[model samples]
Structures are given as structure tokens and as C-alpha cells.
Target: MNQHRKPRAQSAFTQRAVRVGLFAAGAAGIAGAVPAQAATGLPQHSAIAVDQTFSRADFVHHTQARDSFTVRQFGTVNAATARNQANAVGVGCSVDDHCRSVALSFQIVTMAGEHTHLNAINRGDAVNEHCDGCQTLAGAYQFVVSTPRPFTLDKGSQQKLADIHRRLDALTRSTLPATDLKTRADALAAEVNKVLADAVAKAPKGAERPTVTLHRHLDGWPAH
Candidate 1:
């Protein structure tokens, strides 16, 4: 079966939208406890939750306890885009032996300039949509590689990881003066698509088969 591949720019919306499915990779091993200073902060209640239609693995992301931003960290997502990515090549952190537990959490402070909603099915139907300002980001980005256990990516897939990571790290937060619902939703919306893309790219394709689908509710799911 020939699955149509989308252009890089075209996947923007789809990329961000599919984030809901990312939790499916829960079986993959993860890393360890990070310093309070390393986590990315935003605002929200409960860890991220999956729509349940995405996959079988139940993964949730929590907020609240996090490291205060102080001192420079290495290989972090740039503050510019309000995005972050972690690469744990081959060795899954959560599934790996002796690997400590790490956290993956963030809040959608702003929507891409595209039209979207707080609870959007796709970037287009968002209650607050604004594609023009999709790149205008204004928020925080956080991802920490705990001590002892670090984040890695599949060697062959490292490049794919970097591609997605760069897109995530380069997200521009929403503007301050434009305190509007559409603008905020638009910015946050893009990220949703990005997450989906990540899940699609990471999914087990071929005979094993890769799965990709976005249902709803990725808020407050933790990776416990």
C-alpha cells in the first residue's frame, strides 16, 4: 500500500494535530528524574490525557512540580519557538532497565496564527482559528534529560527526531498586545498537529504497522 507523504510545510497542521496520538509510544523506554530547574512550564491541571482512540498505551503528562528556570542548560529547545524535543535513540527510557522516570509536560499558551480552538478537532475547526499567525509563538518550552538516564533516539531515526525537534523548538509564542482568543488558540493549535506528526513518524510502520489518528483530549495524561 502506498501511503501518500505530505510535503514538509503541508504537514504543519496535520503534524500539530496528531499530537494526541503521541501517548501511544508509552511502551518505549524513558529516562529519569530531572532537576526542578529543567522542566518546561505553562499552565494547566492534571497531566496530558489521550483521547483513548489514539492507541492502547495510556500515557499522561503532569504539571505543578517543576524546576525553577535558572542557570543555562545544554541542548535545550530554544526560547524562540516555544517548543521542545527529547531524543532517546533506540533505548526506550520508560521501558529501559534501571532508567529513572522523567516527565513530558507543556501548556498551549498560544495558538499558531491559524484558526483553532481550545478543544479543536483540527487546526481549521478550532473555536479560535488564525492560520496567518501560526508561527507567532509566545510561551515556554521545556524537556529535561534526567541524570543517570538520558534521552536518546533510534540511530537511523535520529535525523527524523531532529527534524521534528527543530520544528518544535522553533515555535514562536503568541504576541502580548494581541490578547485575543483566536490568536492564542491559533498558536497552541499548531503544536497539536506537530504532536500528531511526531506520533506518525515514530509509529511502527510496515508489517508491524504504524497507527495514526487524532480523537480528542490530550490534556492531563501522565507517563506513569
Candidate 2:
């Protein structure tokens, strides 16, 4: 009985080994059947940049004897810029396996400057999306830096200037009668001149004016 049991055990072990070997051979065959391109996969990378600049100059001269003249100049500038850099890598997929990868980049910068005195520079990569193994991801990054001409003004004068800016914005957007809007805008212009004169007259003697630089950074996914 012991001898018979020994032979049965040996037979079972041999059969299991044969099954394993067959399975390995079949797996190798399937792997070999896969296209070389699919086995090595493909990688993609893209980069894009957009740059724009605008400049305008207007000169007006009028000579008249005993005549009152008023000149109003209005200008508007709108600009948009976007930079994108994307990279996608696929690490191969088996014949019986499904694998997908996606990479995307999107960027948009919009600015509306009234009176055309604003200078905007958009630089650097704004978005990067990475994915591996059927994963999906979206990302957006933005860096904004603003440098303005240095100026020294008292706190009161600063507040006045802020108020003037608000009023001007409102007047521009108002739906009131065209003549009324014009009148209000003209008044605000006069106020601006007066504020500038007062600021210059009351400036501190030998005041140390420091240049200010502003930096802002945004990172994450945006809805819509």
C-alpha cells in the first residue's frame, strides 16, 4: 500500500509540472504575437507658445484764434495669451490587457485695459496633465507678475485715486444717456487732474520711493 501511494504522488507532481510548462509556453507565444510597436508603446510631447504686443500713439494739434477747444481720447485694448506643454508615455500593454494614457495642456490669459496704458506679459507653461494606466488628470498653473512705475503719493491721495478709478469704471459701464455718461466722465477727468496737482504740490521733501513688485501663482484644476 505504501509503494502504491508513493507512485500516485509522483504522478500527480509530474502532471502539475506539465500543466505549468504548457501555460508558460502559451503565455510566451501570446507575448511574441503582440506587435513590436504595441510592446514598446509610444510617447508624445508637445509645446506651444503665443506672444503679442500692441502700441498706439496719437498726436493732436489745433490752432484757433479766440476759440475754446476740448479734446477727449479713449482707447481700449484686449489681449489673450496661452502656453501649453504636455507629455504622455505609454509603458506597453499586453495582448490581453488594455492600457491607456493621456496628457493635455491648456492655458488662457485675458485682460481688458481701458485707455491702453496697461502692459501685460504672459510667459511660461500654464498647464500640464499626466496619466498612466488608464488614469485621467487635469492641471492648470499660472504665474502673474506685475511691475508698475514707481510713484509716491500720500494715503489720502491714494484713496482719492482709487475712488476716481471706481467712478470711471462705473461710468464706462453705465447704461444711462450717452450725454450724461460723457458729462460724468469729463468731471472725473477734471478730478483726476486736480488730484495729481495736489499730490505733486504736497509731496514730502526727498521722500524715499520704493518700487513694488507683485507676484501671484495659481495651481489646480478649473471647472469649465
Candidate 3:
């Protein structure tokens, strides 16, 4: 009877050891899965840019005229495209109790990365009042431009959409202003409109084009 009890005790001990080994193996598999889960949840980065500009002008008397132009850009734009995106030219004159100021601001953003350079020129003398066929009297203007990276949307593309929204908000709130502010905002708007129209025309069928919205404010200029 004692020999029978010894064999039974040995059998029970072996069974308990096997159960413990199986539990440890299962916990190890779960630990390995944690990294794979984290990798799936990581956000994928994409390149995008949103550029906007605003211009203001004010004049007092024939001799004292002031013009200001402000340009702001957000997001990561390609260096080459941004370098040559916009060109602005202006001319003004003050002569014989007559003074005038004119400014033009232009900018473009394309699928191709491009740089935008702000150009401003002031010419006119009170004494000579020589008008070199220059025009004056321009008003404030505003422009909005966007360039989205190409992508294909799948059924489960919610994560991609969220990423785009995040980038848009970042660009909208944080704008880089140019050193000089003398470009006509309206002229810039017209240029951006043309760019958007061209983009719409060139888009592929079934492709989702970027959305644009305009916001105007009577409040003073925005802080840099």
C-alpha cells in the first residue's frame, strides 16, 4: 500500500510541473505580441504644406503714404518650389499735392515643392515727383493656398485622415511672416485662386482634392 501511494504522489508532481511550463509559454507569447501591437499603432509621417498671406495699405496726405505687406507660411514645403513660388512688384509716386501707392503680392503652391520669395520696392521722390508710369492706390488683400501629398485611401483610412487634420491645424495656427509687409493681399488671393483652379484641373479622376476655406476678420493684424 505504501509503494502504491509513492507512485501516485510522483504522478501528481509531474502533472503540476507540466501545467506550470504551459502557463509560462503562453505568457511569453503575449509579451512578444505587445511590440507588434505598438508598431501597428505608430503614426506614419507625410509631407504637406499650407501657405496663407495678408496685405494692408494706408495713405495720409500726398507726401506721407504707407504700405504694408505680410506673408505667412506653414508646414514643410519643398525647398526648390518655395524658392520660386511667388513674385511681387509695386510702383508709387507723390507729386504736387497728389500722392499714390500701389502694391502687388503673388504666391503659388504646387504638388512640387517650391520656395516663395517676397519682393517689395519703393520708388518716388517728393521734390522731383517724377511719375515713371507708376500706378498707386491699392487696398488690403488675403490669400489661402494648400498643397497635399499624393496618397491612395483604403477602406480603413481613418488614421490617415486624422494625421492630415493634425497637420492642417498646425499649419493654420503657426504661420511664418515675411520681413516686409507691402504686397496687395487681393492680388495674392487671385494668384492662389489660379493655382487651386489649375490643381483641380490636373487632379486624377476619383482623387480627393484638398479642401479650402476662407476666413476674414475685422480685428487688427494677427500676432506673429
For model 3, how does the per-residue alpha-carbon lDDT over 13-119 read when each residue is reduced to its tens digit? 11112101101010000111011111111232222222222222223332222333222333323321111111111223323333333322122222211232212
For candidate 3, give the lDDT.
0.25
**Cα deviation of 221 in candidate 2 (Å)?**
44
Global lDDT scores for all candidate models: 0.23, 0.25, 0.25
What tens digits encode model 1's per-residue C-alpha lDDT throughout 1-224? 21111111111212234211112111122233222222222222212211101111112311011111111122112221222211111111232221111112232221111111222121111110111111111122232111111122235434543444443333212122223422443444345546434533553333322222222211111111
User: Candidates' TM-scores?
Assistant: 0.20, 0.25, 0.25
| Residue-by-residue lDDT tens digits, candidate 2, 8-50 | 0100111111101101010000111111111111121211122
On a 0 to 1 TM-score scale, where does candidate 1 land against the true structure?
Answer: 0.20
Order of all candidates by lDDT, from best down to worst? 3, 2, 1
Instruction: Estimate the overall C-alpha local distance difference test score of candidate 2.
Output: 0.25
* Stretches of model 1 off by over 4 angstroms after superposition: 1-174, 177-209, 213-224
Each model's Cα RMSD: 21.1, 33.5, 29.4
Order candidates by TM-score, high to low.
3, 2, 1
Off by over 4 Å in 2: 1-151, 204-224
Local error of candidate 2 at residue 58 (angstroms): 26
Candidate 3, which ten residues in sequence have the lowest lDDT sum?
2-11
